[model samples]
Each structure stands twice: as structure tokens, then as C-alpha cells.
Target: MVDTGSANRRDDRTPVLAVAGIGKSYAEGKQRRTVLADIGFEVARGECVALVGQSGSGKSTLLNLLAGIDKPDTGDVEIMGRSIAAMGEPELTLLRREHIGFIYQFFNLIPTLTVAENLALPLELNRIPSAVRRQRIGDWLAKVGLDGREGAFPDELSGGEQQRVAIARAIIHEPALVLADEPTGNLDGRTGNVVLQLLAHLFRDQGRTLILVTHSRAVSEVADRILALDNGRLTHDTEALSW
Candidate 1:
């Protein structure tokens, strides 16, 4: 059985995210299909939480809810102490740009933008000065082992290299939260393992809160807590984890 003992440790600080009683549904052929039901969880600052389940188990639905890409029919979602459920699209956009970062399974890098430009996009959107953005791009690219490839476009890089660019883009702005959806799903096992270890280490060292949705056991092993989703509900909130 999944343990709830750590749920009591939430008083550690204000959670980076607080999800309460969230539910989502869609209509199909005049029938309402529920995708998630009464889902609730809290991710504290600097914590890495993993959501694992079979395909069609609503893992992506939960990630969408957390990212504000979709809204729940019931319940509220608070991010960085702000209520996302009540925000209009414009406000939500601003909040996301300013405080949240996303890493996608497909690397989501703009094919037309060069590597350095891609990494600088977030900071540019935040209106940071060009000099600062340039410096950050240079430093992060080197850290990701892609130094001197700044002028290359996404199409010019291999899958692993593209993913490394995605990672650099996600954290360059130093957002308070990072949401990764099957981050390594596109790489071979060995390459995926290397990227996963890099991501886990970087997020921890930066003290960024992470909520990762993944099916890989290797990915799940890096989380500080593991929660399992079944059907439309959370079936497990495993015991506290360290490392």
C-alpha cells in the first residue's frame, strides 16, 4: 500500500504547487468521459515528484492541469501562492512566462531558431537585457555539453543534443517550477539515462520544484516521491524518498 505519512510534512513551507480536489472530463458522442477525479497533491519547493501509470491513465491530463494548459471542472490549483483557476488567459500566460518552465517529450525546440537563440527565448520573453541573455546562453550551452554549437539549428542536432537544448531552454530563466512530460521518451535507453541523470542533478542543484510525468522506471527512480495514477484517481502516494 502507498503510504500517506509524508503528507503531514507539508508544513515545511508553502508548496510550489497545491492541487485540491481537481477533476476533468471531456465529451464524446454525447457522453461525458472523466479523465481525472478528485485529484489532490502538493509539491513543495525544491521537491521532485513523479507521476507514473499505464498509458491512458490520465498522467498527461494531470500535467496539463498543473501547467494551466487545461482547467479542471472542479477544484483549484495554486502555483507559487497564486490561484491559477481564477486567472484569465492573459494572466495565466504572464504567470507561466514568469514562473513556470516546461520540458517536453519531443524537445519542442523551434526548428528555425539557432541553439543559442532557443536557449535565450525564455529570458528574452522576460525582457532581460540582451547581454545577460547572451551570457546565460553561453554558460548553459557549455554546461549541457553543447558549447560552440550555438549557431546550429534544432534540425542540425541529434535527438540527444536536441533534448539537451530543451533542458537548457527550460532552466535558463530559473523559473520557480519545471514540469517535464516524458522528458526522455524520445531517446534510446542509454542516452535517455544520461539525460535523465543530468536533468535530475540540475534541478536539484538549482532548487527548482519539479513534477515529472513519466512511464520509465529509471525516470521514476530519480523522484523524491512517487505517485501512481490508476483509471482516473491517484492510487498511490508512496513513502518519502531521499536521493
Candidate 2:
């Protein structure tokens, strides 16, 4: 028999994210290569989980799958008990817009938009009322320590500041799950720690589920659980991990 990865515990409350028997493959010439196989795990509501591994471990691919940016070749990804495979691109886009917040390594901010406008873009796309959007933008900007820099364009901000803006834009809508792919990869140790702490603390205070991908041991230590992504699969999961 083959091992089916691992799990922590099944809390009575519904999981914010669940992946069962997930597998992915791609064609290499005339043959197929498996990227991930038999991946399974559950992240409880309000839990912060880290997916850690070396490069080429398929960690980012898994993030894309979970965020509904790509489809799995097998098994299912359920966010809030809804199967992501059952939705189309439009629906998946809306789902992400409404419930998922994504942060990237390079801080993908719109260069043409000021910090304030960029932060307000998602709210406007979601059709949040103008008054409410304004308030949320102001609130999150301050929360992320970007209040005074709101009028600065992305190109005008420093690396750390740009990342803060990215984070502010992500959580402005109070997403249920925040998927961060190497959110601090571009920062130096000091700045990286600050960004990591801000992300972790925000999730903790809001009771939101967070799936963060990082290779930094210090970063993973902050999570409620540490999940290993190996050979494109979730091979191990440990709760309340301490170095």
C-alpha cells in the first residue's frame, strides 16, 4: 500500500481549505511526468499553515491549484467545502476576488496606479460601495503602515514599502484565505521578518486561514502548522511546530 501523506486533526469546525488525493501531471515528449501524487491535508478555520520546500518542489504550483488559478488533473481542492474543480474560470475568478487573497514574491503592484488607487482597485472590482471602499482603503493602508505613502506610485516606493502595499491590497476585502507565495523572498532578513510577522499577525488577529509558501525556517516556525511539499505532493504535516 502507498502512503497517503498525512493530516493533523479533524476539528469539529469546517476546514477553510482541504486537499484530497490531489495529483498533477504534464507531458514530457510522448510520456507523462507526475508532478504531485496523493496529496492530502486540511487547514482549520483561522489556522496558518506553511508549505515549505526547496525549489522545484511544486510548492508554487500547489498554490496556483488551491487558488483556482489552475486545475488539478486528479482529486479535488475544496475551499470552504466547495470543490474548486466544479467551477469555471469566471466563477473561480469571482471566488478568488471575494474570498481569496494572494501575495506574490515579487510584489505585483500596478506601476501606473498610486498606492491608494491600487489598494482600492479590488474593492471597486467587487462593486463595494464607494463610501465603504474609501474607508477600507484608508483603514488597510494605515494598518499596513502605508498611510503616508498612499499617493506614491509603485516605482517610487522601496522594496519593503511595495510589499506592504501588496499586502494591504490583498486583505482589504477580508478574504477567508490568504495564499502567499514567498511573500518575503525579495526582502533582506530584517525587512523580510517584518513582512512575515505582519502577514502572520494579520491572519491571527482576523481569524483567517493562511497558506504561506516559504523556504525560510524562521518563517515557517511562526505558522500553526508546517506542511512539506515534496515531489509535487504534500508528504508531511506537523502542527504547532517549533524549531
How high is each candidate's TM-score? 0.93, 0.92
Model 2: ten consecutive residues of lowest lDDT: 3-12
Q: In candidate 1, where is summed lDDT lowest over 10 consecutive residues? A: 3-12
Query: What tens-digit string does per-residue lDDT give for candidate 1 at 22-121?
Result: 9999999899999999999988899999999999999999998998999999999999778899899999999899899999999999998999888888
Per-residue lDDT of candidate 2, residues 115-163 (tens digit): 9899998898889999998888888887888777778999998899899
Which residue pairs does candidate 1 place in steric collision? none
Residue 59, candidate 1: Cα error in Å is 0.8
Q: Where is model 1 more than 4 Å wrong at Cα?
A: 1-12, 240-243
How big is the positional error of residue 142 in model 2, measured in Å on the Cα after superposition? 1.3
